[model samples]
Target: MARPSSDRLGYLLVAPTVLILLSITAFPLAYNLWNSLRHVVLTDPSSAGFAGLENYRALLGDPQFAQVLARTSLFTVVSVSVQMAVGLMVALVLHRRFRGRGLVRAAVLIPWAVPTVVAAISWKTMLDPQSGVLSFLFGVDTAWLAGEWTAWIAIAVADGWKTVPFVAIILLAGLQVIPGDIYEAARVDGSGAWHAFWKLTLPLLKPALMVALIFRTLSALLIFDVIFILTGGGPGDTTETLSYVTWREFLVESDFGGGGAVSVLMLVLSLVIAGAYTRLFRLDRREG
Candidate 1:
């Protein structure tokens, strides 16, 4: 038998990995899409049948779903904006040549390194009405998780604390790769620090910013864990996000069809947002 060529061998090597991906990701996605198009209520298996676009129509007509979408959008915007701003500041500081810089960077990563569940639980404890440190500091016994607005704030704080470090590290890497000679050249041209940051640093940092934005936006849009653990979508469903609602449909209500519909919609929204960011970044690059 003739030996396989390099190109054929490369495909052969990757074939198994591709097969694994198809088995896990592609199979589940296809199954979900099928489920989304049919009624699949575990509680009423006898009535399960082709739903067509019924579930999608129902969800779109639901005021609660509209609220969930609005809330999720707000959360994504707020969380991502705050994370980017704080992350950029942290990255800038870390990019400086200060003593104990490495130690500081490692310390800054502690929040990101901590597991999400642990961070969420810790935040819950800290925001407890009676004995929480935050309540004591504010000099009020307000129940942070009992109020709708306060609950949102607490969730944002917890999410931002855990994720800001990751954004900072990514931005810091971007900053490191930026040739220092650019700054030197700016200095030679009598450019101020603020001017260079606006004109040079931000323009060059667009790629990294785009990356962090997409990741944070998607995570925020699908936020569940912190809300689940912290508030259980409490304060009268005020914190119930799209993911939480989907989970409720699948597990609580045993409505797989509805859950799959929500999941499909979420996937579409994520793709749209990601594509928008990518397109915007490419346009900015071209214009620059």
Candidate 2:
């Protein structure tokens, strides 16, 4: 009887907080779903009606949306891959005992600490063809953000510069928790640095790698600020992502139903990607 009473009291204590959280998150989601199922163009109020799945069907049938989806996926893959590679290298370097190691660590975090908009703007300025430092150094007059591939390269570099430190920090934490004795034993067994890293370090770093990969992948998939500030999805909408499309629908086109549908789709995509990453990591752990 006492145990049951105590459990009830505990539940009562947390009930308010749980309810608040649900109200904040669940209510908005429910509203968005409702909005998605109706035609709600702000400019054309008389045309509003029940849309059912019409918005989704229209989005799916559009060739531009298909291109945007593919572009977003490719950008996510490229940005996450580059960030992981560079971050791992930085983590390995930071793990070593060196002069001014603390300073180097702090310096490495400066890029990540900067605001995303500021970072994007800085990159935009640096890539300016007429007066940019990069153009002067490379002795080329190419407009970095004017071309399709070059613009992507610029965005990738900017995003990587801002995010690689976060991945490195996560990896560095994982590295620190690893037992040094294992490395000593490997060295005694005549295993070289590369062999030890491949056979021992990587296996132990899986959890941190998974965390970093999931975070960076999701951020890349929903990327908006950098593209908004730098390219504005210009040079013929080549860099526009799903998030941008959603924004265009809601804010630009005044199509609330279309925007709501895009938002719901984005939510679904995020959930699916997160679940996939969690499952993949679990599988890797089981295999290991």
Candidate 3:
């Protein structure tokens, strides 16, 4: 029949993309699972044999893994929270039409347009202890990456600067989609701007805010390039995140088995967080 032939043609048309996704994503994940169960190391690739769950057990027992997990959680929590706050403020300001609004919007996106490596290098230069702009401007020579707190601050600054604009853009789109009549109605009901914002705007913007938070949280959890280029997980590994630890295991220490285990753990953590967000968003959407 024509319908059967059409379905077959459609399947053939989409087959290549599905095959590519499976090859690139599914295959690597499967390979990593197999690799994690082995004892492969840089110096003993030939002697590598199945080690079962030993790598995962060792990873769980390692205290450094615990510290990295803690640091990663703090980083993701603090950075995502700050980025959302700043982004919401920016979005609220841009929601209203004003003179040079388009120019302002474009300017805000400039930070987001810059590459992560470039932003990291720039922030590192700006925050350097000696001959840095902050020290020169403030007349205080403080090492931004020398102390754990300072290093975290520097990393947060760079990340928030780069990502806040993305959150703002998403929220701005949501704000624009909101009907103007709602605000007019609130005004007619003698509601102050603050009341209307907190009562109406915030509730309406919940879906967009959740989406932005999930995106920013995931990205913040996987933060590496900025910290790597800026602090190198220095100050006695105080700034070492899970991604950094994973990178060090595979690339620096050349322990494929341990690295694969870390990768699996990272994947699981991300999935858990994403799943929570997905469930919350679905519930919100149903209510809305």
Candidate 4:
């Protein structure tokens, strides 16, 4: 009886936190669903009308939405791939000790620590056409943000620059945890550095690589702040992503119903990506 009462008290203690989470996250989700089913205009509350699935249908048929989805997929894939590759290289290079290695590691982390908005703005300045260093050094007058493909590249570079450090840090932790004696034993067996890295390092680093890739991929999928600051989803909607579309719908167009549909789509995409990652990684193997 006393144990049951103690358990009840513990539940009571955690109840508030649970309620707060529901209030913040779950409530909005429920509200969005409800709003999506109705024709609700923020500027005109009188326009509230039950539209059922019309908002969803409208969004699905919107060509602009399709284009945005494609752009988002491309951005996620390209940016995450580049970030992972570069970050892995950085981690491997930093794995070995050398003079000023510690200082270099700290300096590389500066991009990660900087605010996203500031980084985007800084990159924008550096890529500016007339007075930009890149334009001057390359001897080309290219408008990065004014073009569709260029805008995506700009966004990717900005996103990668900020996130590569994080991936390197995660991989570095994984590398440090690897037993040094394993390398020594491999060397005794006449395994060269390249062979050891391929056979031993790669195998041991799978979990960390998966983790880094997932983190970077998910972050890239929902990229918005940098793009918004840099392009505002302009250049003829060339760089518009899902999040950008949703923002424009809710804030710019003031169509809560349409925005709700976009939000639902985003949620679905996130779940699908998460499911795919889980299946690909076979995390169940670890459980067994």
Number of the top-ranking candidate, with TM-score as the measure: 3
Candidate 1 residues 1-288, lDDT tens each?
Answer: 455687799999999999999999999999999999999999899989999999999999999999999999999998889989999999999999999999999999999999899999999889888999988898989988999998999999999999999999999999989999999999999999999999999988988888988899889899999999999999999999999999999999999999999999999999999899899988988887
Backbone clashes in each candidate structure, one number apiece? 0, 0, 0, 0
The reply for model 1, stretches above 4 Å from the true place, is 1-7
Tens-digit lDDT track for model 4 on 96-193?
99999999999989999999999999999999999889999999988988987788788888988999999999999899999999999999999999
Model 4 regions more than 4 Å off:
283-288
200-225, model 2: which lDDT tens digit per residue?
99999999999999999999999999
TM-score-best of 2 and 3: 3
lDDT of 1 at 11: 95
Candidate 3: worst-modelled 10 consecutive residues by lDDT: 39-48
**Alpha-carbon RMSD of each model:** 1.5, 1.6, 1.1, 1.9
Cα shift from native, residue 85, model 4 (Å): 0.6
Could you tell which candidate, 1 or 4, scores higher by lDDT?
1
lDDT of 3 by residue, 201-234 (tens): 9999887998899899998999999999998999
Q: Supply the TM-score for candidate 1.
A: 0.96
TM-score of each: 0.96, 0.95, 0.97, 0.94
* Cα lDDT over the full model 1: 0.94
